[model samples]
Target: MKTSLQTTAFAFATSAVLAAPALADEWRLNNFLPETRPESAQIEKFAEDVNTALAEKDFSIEVYHGGSLGLPNTDLLRVVPTGAVEMSLMWANYLGRDAPALGSVFVQGAISTVDELTDVLPVAQEIYEEEYSEWDVTTVGFVAIPTLSVSVFCRDEPVNTLEDLRNVKLRVWAREQVETFERLGVAAQIIPQEETYVALRTGVVDCALYPALYAKTISLQEVTGYASFLYPMASAPYALGVSDALWESTDPEIRDAITQAADDLWDRTNQYDADIENEMAARESLAEEGIVWSEDFPESDRALFVEAVSETWKMLAEEAGGNALDYRERMLTALGR
Candidate 1:
């Protein structure tokens, strides 16, 4: 009788062990920036929050920084679709191959400020789903990485007006920028940010069109002599996307926990970036390191700059399957534009 009772208890124990599920899978996140960059900092915070939430819910994640997963800029769209990586933080412009329609959201003079961006995302989301579905990625969150002011950063000469931008060799991204600048008689080169400084130093490119944050983070200010405040480039915000295959395959409870964690992260990280802007002293500290913030330039120049790029906007809108006008109308309706 004793032997029979022991055998029954062992059978029950083995059954329970077999029925219990395995630990949840850990996710991999990839970004192009160095681990020290502010964008990486924001991502790290998000990962931490998500990991914590996951721990409570019996799931986890592992972040891979600095493109360690071998996702070069060129293969971004293809890589995401093939599930080579689980998630990535990249500029939407990079996905132009798979989804040119996303560019409609960031055309010059199209989106002026962060408030306008937040209001326009609902419409953008609809468009992203249609476009990104082809690429097999889902837009999880759209966070503005502070408002970026575009300018010609040069080591040799100062570009103080719209005419000064003409005939200069500038490094730029996005097809529209290339087309627009070329039309204005400026020679445009499409180069990655990693190579921009060297390009400036070597004179391969005479100048670059990028953000002030580049000055703060990478010391581009020290490398350049002039920063022409042209159209405020606030709309080219960073977006975080997840591989649809991975997301769809994830356990439902784990997916819910991760989505909630992402929501929490967006609030925390964007608030931090915004709070830094609110504190004048903090912004000044960054400015002291060669950042020149001025709207004091001639208002006349703004019109010329806009006129030069206006046709490019129309071209992009037409290319994006009429999304350019649709997005503009949606934003104006939201902002009473």
Candidate 2:
């Protein structure tokens, strides 16, 4: 009787051990964009989707927004590879100082529309993956936050021609924008986006070059009176990267689940960009705020702007070295420029 009782106890212990779940591998994802932005909302959805897809696996992701994680937006390239952060949504142009080749995606006239961007995305992903691998990071996905166009919003006067932009202090971001504006004979001021409203209101800068939706979000329309539709600057693409160590250690199934979630988000981004509701909301906001909108630039002016930006691209490619130039050429070819 004693032997039988001991055997039953041992079998129960074994069953309990076998039924226990494995420890979960938790990952942290960082996005520097404000939580209210559509991009940040999409990142949150991605985390939820990934969790759902990997429900059976011991994998999870926790998201941090608005720089809460203490990682500077510009340092993602350095930090992501060291496993200091498990994942990040990094802007391509932020790396221009060190790797100008990565900024080729934001070449002003390279890709103009969502359709064009969608067509070139596969090639872009391939190029980006190869470039980022040098930092021991793997590209899981890419997103191009939609804008009506890269526009020029002026405080008092309208910017309708290249001549109109002459000597005008316009807020700019990224090295490409500075060079492009320089060629166009505009004074480019590198102002933080958060500070742009006060800059415009106080006349620190005469105009700003940014997306219309963003301008509305920040109440920039309160100070700006007119907007000019410039040639479609390719949306500066954002990449979602995973640390190489985490990626390699993760189960293949978990990796696929995470990748699928990202790919689905990528596929849906185009629709989101084209959503009429979002477009109408932006229009309503601008109208309510009483910001005047200018018609598109004349073809002649548009052509000249494109020409000036094209020259800047050539100069940037040269300055960035042989590989950078080669990457630009490949992107141009892929983009059918």
Candidate 3:
């Protein structure tokens, strides 16, 4: 009983609905930091950016923060290459056992400040691309959250001078940090980030070296009485990597969009960190709450520390050998040292 015009319109609508494609790809991005940290916020921003940029594409990114995926920070390099997870923000130094050259970023005094770290990133990116490719992953980019320094937080007394660190038990993250402390005559213990708070409170370690933002995250200021804003001995290089298979299979346009999103995220996060006002204000708030902030150690002590840590780099380079050694040399040259 339908008119010929009405029947034609009904047929056209059915074909259009059937022709529309469903969302076919979903990517999982794993992050180790809790959602509250700026690092995690940036990761979330990256997801949103990529999704928006690729709105016409049939792909989506879902971020899993705070290790909700049950992957430890150390297992990222091993797990991410298998295509089980589409991407991850991994701490580069955790792979030191197998890739010492990649771990070199965590070597105390290797890069000094965030500006130096930024300057060396091009060379670092090349090294990471070559190295991560071998593991079947594609490097997205390197991220520096906040800045490149770690402050000392202590329970018994303030570490205002290098001499104060002598014989003091401190919690460290990597072998490079341990070697750096050893050179200063301090006892260093490798502690996982999750366990550091309880260890500090229970007196298992007298002092700890961590980013100031992290201290606030774990509420260490409530447990520790002093903090010293020392020049960074080492900064963990954070890298975002995607599975090589996924990268190859993605549409070319989508791939380009994702890359652009990564670059945008890096620029935006660096600008946020460079502002300094937010960080200083947070520190001031902490100070008002009774945390004693010590003056920076003398330049002479910093010089000696840098010199001593440089020796450790030579040992690392020799140990890493082959491409790692080459990469290390390239990084050193890039740093103009």
Candidate 4:
């Protein structure tokens, strides 16, 4: 009953429908840190830049901070490559058991200065890429946090030497710190940063192994009057990881844009060696807040601490168990230590 003209038109409509491209849903990026941190701002800017470049693409990005999407930090290595989550900023030190290779890559006390840390980062980045690829993910970017210097802040008196630390309870952040201090014969315990102020005020701990730059955050000057510099606080920077599936599917132009944005982030953090400068400024501010600073933690004692920490690093590599020793040696070589 249909005319030839009508049949032809129907055929043309079906062809057009078949030729249309399928648009993708918004890609989500999970940030495990609070929105208040400076690094969050940098990440948001990265997303903004990438989205701008991706305006013509079928896909876009939306960053979710503080794990609002219920993605667990500990399970990132297992979950990231499966494409269940498209992208995430992973904190390596927190994932010791989930991915030992990641934890073995680096730690907080690895270096004594930001410059030294930066010098060794090229090697570290390589390890990160290699380890993440095994999980079927690609490294896209890095978010460098503030370089807070590690120090001991005590409530009433100056914690000057090894013996002073042994006299009063010392609060530390992780097992690494606990082991390092215990090896030096100091009584130390793991106390969460958020609860540190309350712990110090209530006499639960007499001293805390904290960062001077961050002391102002919890107003440590109020509870702790004495502080001493220990070393440059170093840890693995948050890594921006993309699922290999998603990365491979991306258009080349968009992919380049993402890579450019990530490169910009790395350059931003290292440009002026400004993080250490900021830490120095914060120390001065803490002093203004009535906190007295000291350099009485002698080089002799520091050498002992570093030696103990080095042993812990080896233990971490052994637990990781997959050419982790090679990675450690490469890192040590880069550090010239």
TM-score leader: 3
User: Looking at model 4, which ten-residue stretch has the lowest summed lDDT?
Assistant: 1-10
List model 4 lDDT by residue over 259-288, tens digit each: 998888777754436767877888899999
Clash totals, every prediction: 0, 0, 1, 0
Evaluate all candidate structures by whole-model CA lDDT and list the values in order: 0.64, 0.74, 0.73, 0.76
Model 1 C-alpha lDDT per residue in residues 1-337, reported as the tens digit of each score: 3234334434443443224422446667777776767668778877777777677665666667766655665456655554455677767676665556666666666565667666665666566565666566776765545655665676687766556667577888667788777776777878877777788888898888876555545557667766655666555556677768777887787777667766766676553245335434433554676655444237786665577666776677677775556864554576565
Instruction: Please report, as a residue range, the 10-residue window in candidate 3 with the lowest summed lDDT.
Output: 1-10
Query: What would the per-residue lDDT of candidate 2 be over residues 179-217, giving only the tens digit for each residue?
Result: 877777778977867678899999999999887766665
**TM-score ranking, best first:** 3, 2, 1, 4
For model 3, the stretches where C-alpha displacement exceeds 4 angstroms are 1-24, 56-58, 233-237, 272-279
Per-model TM-score versus the true fold: 0.80, 0.84, 0.85, 0.79
Tens digits of per-residue lDDT for model 3 on 1-337? 1133234433443343224322347787878787878788888888998898877776788888877776667665666665556788877677776556676544656666666767776677677788878777798876665554567889888886788877578988788778877877778889987788899999999999876756677778877888887676325457899878878988888788789888888787664344356657766877887889888777888887787788887777787777767877788787787
Error of 2 at 284 (Å): 4.0
Locate the minimum summed-lDDT window of 10 residues in model 2.
13-22
Q: Please identify model 2 stretches exceeding 4 Å from their true place.
A: 1-24, 55-58, 272-281
Best model per lDDT: 4
- True-vs-predicted CA distance for residue 108, candidate 2, Å: 2.3
